[model samples]
Target: MTSTESSSRPYGAFPVRIGFQVQPQHAEYGQIRRAVAAAEEAGVDIVFNWDHFYPLSGEPEGLHFECWTMLGAWAEATERVEIGALVSCNSYRNPELLADMARTVDHISNGRLILGIGSGWFEKDYQEYGYEFGTAGGRLDILAEALPRIEQRLSKLNPQPTRNIPVLIGGGGEKKTLKLVAKHATIWHGFGDAETVAHKHAVLDQHCADVGRDPGEIERSVAVSDSPEKVGQGLLDVGTRLFTVSASGPDYDLGLLREWISWRDEQNK
Candidate 1:
């Protein structure tokens, strides 16, 4: 790997890995469960569901399942593949309580959990759940405060996390979000094309430097929309190693996932 690729990650290199986000909406739980199983068998490095009370696309009132509860079941269902939300809304649960939930799930998965969290943006979720729908800056502030609390609680939990329980903070806010990523995240998930993500990577590297952290300590993750052949190399040429592709129910097709997995295998070789 070149300096351009590992500039932020200096300790060791991260192999190209694929992640699948199984959106739990407009489908039965049975179908959702099956999708996760198939993704693991198909060879994804991670499995994720979004943290929301409703559908993010299509019908606004479509059938949906809660995030953490489904994760509890996934922990028991899959023997491989790390599991968590693409980004759990930090405002939806008390940070300490969220930490315990993550710990319990970590134990259930025998340590295959990734706590992906963010400052949240869905207004309907807050209104329906009766959480304070505050300003974007306010929400980010709340997320900033909550991360430390979650880490502290995780340290005090009974058995402690099986591992440090990798924290994946999702967002591209150059200011607050990247700074938090520099300070705490084991993985930083963001959206955008190669150029955009490269800019974010540089900003994050500066943040890492300012905080006296090794830039390479954090893995860069990005979401993919096109075929691997179309979007993969551009991202890899930069620093992104964990490429996530999202699938929505009812079918939750594994074709896209398989393509990405195959591409990952080729890249790693």
Candidate 2:
């Protein structure tokens, strides 16, 4: 492993950040609104929702909402915490249009937007919604092509984004995904156990080296379980600074979010 992957890096230098993904499913819209408020109140750094038409779990017919529209509402409703999809599917809309939507949301939130996006999976969404469900590699190829267009569109917007509006790419495909991340992402959202994270980080670092970018230029984010005492420290040691715990409706239990917030406070101190 590179020194960049070593544990000797100052813990203080790697300040811990936490995010909450309030899965927009299995509850009324009001319940989701309340959950977002509660998560912000609990002191998360960012709030996220997934982009899909149907419920990812439980009843396929359960209550669900579209991703970008909810994001617009979230931009209006919240004041502090950054808002975005955990990942919007790159295949759903034209890249330029997605860029405009993100720019508008960035304005609405007064600069608190993280454009988390992915190549897309879940074939049912594509089929039911009249999209082409192609091979995974084909979808990734589409994402690779669209990312630059999105950036170009962002550059051309009339009322530019409040800030650059950080781009967060979510996926674990070591070849194309990590390469795109090395090239385009401000943040890379990944998942796995500590060993998995370490291996992927090394792969990502190699991708960065191949592209002549410092791997450290990109922040490492991971979706972690609620119990920080059990698994959080391992991930942190592997260079993951941003930890996200997901909460689903209807009750949207925030007990884990609270624990992570407390853990973040302790670690940062």
Q: Report lDDT (CA) for all predictions.
A: 0.92, 0.91
lDDT of 2 by residue, 1-269 (tens): 34355556432255789999999999999999999998898789999999999999999989999999999999999999999999999999999999999999999999999999999999889999999989999999999999999999999999888898899999999989999999999889999998998888889889988999888778889998749999888888888899999978898999989999999999888
RMSD of 2: 2.0
State in Å the error of residue 144, model 1.
0.7
How high is each candidate's TM-score? 0.96, 0.96
Cα distance off (Å), candidate 1, residue 151: 0.8
- Residue runs of model 1 more than 4 Å from their true location after superposition: 1-12
TM-score (C-alpha) between model 1 and the true structure: 0.96
Question: What global local distance difference test value does model 1 have?
Answer: 0.92
Clashes of each: 4, 0
Per-residue lDDT, model 1, residue 23, is 98
